[model samples]
Target: MMMKAVLVDDEPLALGFLKRQLEKVSSIQVLETFTYFDSSSNISVIKETDIVFMDIEMPERNGFQLAEQLLELNPGLEIIFVTAFNQYAVQAFEVHALDYILKPVQTERLKKTVKRAEERINAKQEAISEKPTKLCINVSGELMFHLTNKDPEIVTWRTLRARELFLYLLHNRDRSINKDVLTELLWAEVDQEKAYAQLYTTIYHIRKTLSNYRDYLTLKSVQGGYKLILSNTIIDLYVWEKKLKNLSTLEGQTIPIAEELMAIYKGGYLQEYGYVWAEAERVRLEQQWVEAAQQLAAYYHDQGNFSSAERWYRELCNKHPDDEISNYQLFKLYALTGKNKLAEKQYQIFKKALEDIGTGVPHTMEKWYMNWKQGIARKTSM
Candidate 1:
């Protein structure tokens, strides 16, 4: 079945251009085109479509605002944004949009995005077939395994490492773990020959255990060593990471992604493993989180939503207490809101935190904090 699509752009040229470009791909069926998002119009015209190619700068309401309304009528709709600006990446992903195509969409990129959509749709359809067969496999006497969320035969409580082969491969996501690295990470103390033989046996058991659902997941040998080939369907972490990306972008528009991001961020990422790549990714995402909060705070502040700005600032303060600039901003904001005591308290915290970090306050900020605190204290005392 062909995937239905629609183009929503207020600009005539942009709409016409995307329609023509998308028409090149016969598989993508553009059902309708909307110049603006008007509820009075039968929104179902676009809502019924499987995918939406929407523009952010449409008249009346932007893409996100429009998407909120559209999804009320169509929950599972996939939106691919066609935008002239890239700065809105955060907002795009915040909504869980399928993908973002910059203006003047390239044929190759559009095709790739379409292919990805096809893969997802196919996986979803397969999931609806018959509730997915739930089965289990016991690897040797130590390992228990699962399919479709069903726990395997438990001779004993187990972890992925119950089968050393799966443990090493599972730890390596989308990357082939080298035999030497596996030897080092898995069994540095054991004899090399013994380790290799054990590894081969482990691999065989893994394949045997997972053979039933091989289409959904597999362990395959590569030039380097081997790869655990699992579809995006089974890995909740992939979905979790992608949800973060959607919330992080300006186009991956899905509502409730915010709640999902917060819920999924219950703990440090991949808390079970401390692989170098995993740790690096964790730090990168954490940095991105702070940067995003800062951007959103500044955006809200400029939009005259001071309360929201202050909320984000406070969160940032808690996360990055040593940031002198963030502290200064909060102190000033507190003073503006007539919370002199709170401002004074925050300034002291800032002073102490700065001192603790061994970075002295800047002269300009020091003068302001001193002056503000003294003035407030004098006003209270007087």
Candidate 2:
């Protein structure tokens, strides 16, 4: 398959040389070349192009910053940073560039880069074509959709209002919402007629955008408002929750299944989107995850699996820094294991966590710490 590429270099000579060399490669098709990014015209082409060959140094905007903007437009777009200096190699990969080639570019090296880009593009295409038709939506970390065999891609909404309206419907999918309720929630500032008109236009845009997934999703006009019906759809949050509910107890055999379920709850529900309406459900789901994690951690602790217990408890503490139970458990585990310094550090952290919330350690916890400290002192004296 022929892969499309775009080149960006401030120097006309270097840009021409790279373009000419790419033309020699049979698989690559140079689509456009830019001396520097013209925010207006270049963005559309960048979105359409498959790969970008860019220089590290430029006058208008450095290649790193421009590459970032381009990747934001098309996350799948492969970036190959070509520069004379080798020091930028580390930073180039940090931004997830495909390859770093130094100038003056060599024929053999350019061929290798082109071959790699072609393989990557072909792999992505094959992945999409290989799988059966299935719709997967992930709202755990962010709003992303995977249709058929394609990789998960974030929906680029036509407008902010369009995005918000779609998410609102999705949050309350399978049920018809009232038009008055939606208008009041989203377009309260506008006049009634204008709000309704804007709503109609936004709905039209959404339907046009989702026309490709007509088999799996349907945005229907109900008696009053609209309903988003999902068919043959696998939502990550739903699958995780359902599996979690089915697991009655965590046993030696069941531990792995429970661990898999924990992994499915990637992050708080719709956490990245920050939709105020999603907050309640997010909190509820988070609490469920915490309860399950607590159960798993307690089981490991009881089974004398200190390493696994510490791993899960630390994960819990990382997710919920002010979780008193996990913090105290870690403290006890470390103290009993004769790691007194780690125990002390954990105790201090627990104290500070509570203090941050305008509280202090509970009397029972304080008493336990004091007793442990006295015991340590006695042992030292002995």
Candidate 3:
């Protein structure tokens, strides 16, 4: 396969020479050359191009920064940094540049870089084609499929109906969903006959998308309905909830386990998708996480682990900024630890959060703060 490349060098001589050298390699096709990095002009070409040969020292920006931006646009785009200095070699690899070739690029060295780029591109393509043995469905944030020993693959649905239908089936997997219910839920705007036809077409697309994971996920028709069966597959939310249920009382031995559970919660269930059907589950799972986090923080506070307590409470406050109990706990913890400024900051945050929702700080909390302030004033006078 021919690999398309772009050359970016501030020096006209260097840019022309690199392009000429690349021309020597039959596999490398020079698509575009740039004297400077211009986002507007370069972005469109960079998207289609396979490789970029960039100089480390440029007028607008260093090659490392430019490469980072390019990678963000096309993550699969290979970057080969060409420069006169040997010092930038280490920095080149730091940004994951494919190869670092010195200036006055040799034909042999250039060929080696081209070969390496081709190998990497081919490997990525092969990985995409390979089927996964086991599957892990992540619904905590966005919908993602984490295949065993492979990067998470985001499913690209053929159409909106196909996406919603597949998510609905996955959400209620193992139970046969009647065609009538699905039709009413998704295709209510269409006529009955047209709706059914659309459903069938959507299901076909879903099946084709899941063809690689057929061994793990089986979507079958069951007597006027459809069912999605999971074998050797797990959903992150289910696994997290199960572990939370099985967890015993929090202690020195169980603290690590609690921390591990906290790490697993990437975000609310299907948070990014914003599916109305998933709202209840999302709120429920979030509450579960909040409760677990509160229990862990309280345990640390009770055991006189003030530092750990502060850390967990801060985490809770970050995730649920309006959580009054967590904010109060953090305020008290900071006060006890002699971080009066942080304690006051926490109180102000709590106050603003409550006020935003048309509420005030609880009377008892206000009274406690007033009393604490008076005591501080008395001590300061002495």
lDDT of candidates 1 onward, in order: 0.70, 0.88, 0.90
- What's the true lDDT of residue 195 in model 2? 90
TM-score of each: 0.48, 0.63, 0.62
Candidate 3 residue-wise lDDT, 1-382, digit = tens: 9988888999999999998898899998888888987866668898999999999998758999999889878878899999999999898999999999998999999999899999999998897688746789998888889988899999888997787888899999999999999999898999999999988988999999989888689898989999998988999988999999999988899999989988989999989878899899999999999999889989989999999889989999988778888988898898899998898888888898888999999998999888878878898899
Could you give candidate 2's per-residue lDDT for residues 53-120 as a string of tens digits?
99998996888998888876886899999999999999999999999999999999999988988898
lDDT of 2: 0.88
Each candidate structure's count of clashing pairs? 22, 0, 0
Residue 284 displacement in candidate 2 (angstroms): 1.4
TM-score of 1: 0.48
- TM-score pick, better of 2 and 3: 2
Question: How much does candidate 3 score in TM-score?
Answer: 0.62
- For candidate 1, write residues 14-46 as lDDT tens digits: 899889888898788888887975755766685
Query: Cα deviation of 230 in candidate 3 (Å)?
Result: 0.7
What does the lDDT come to for candidate 1? 0.70
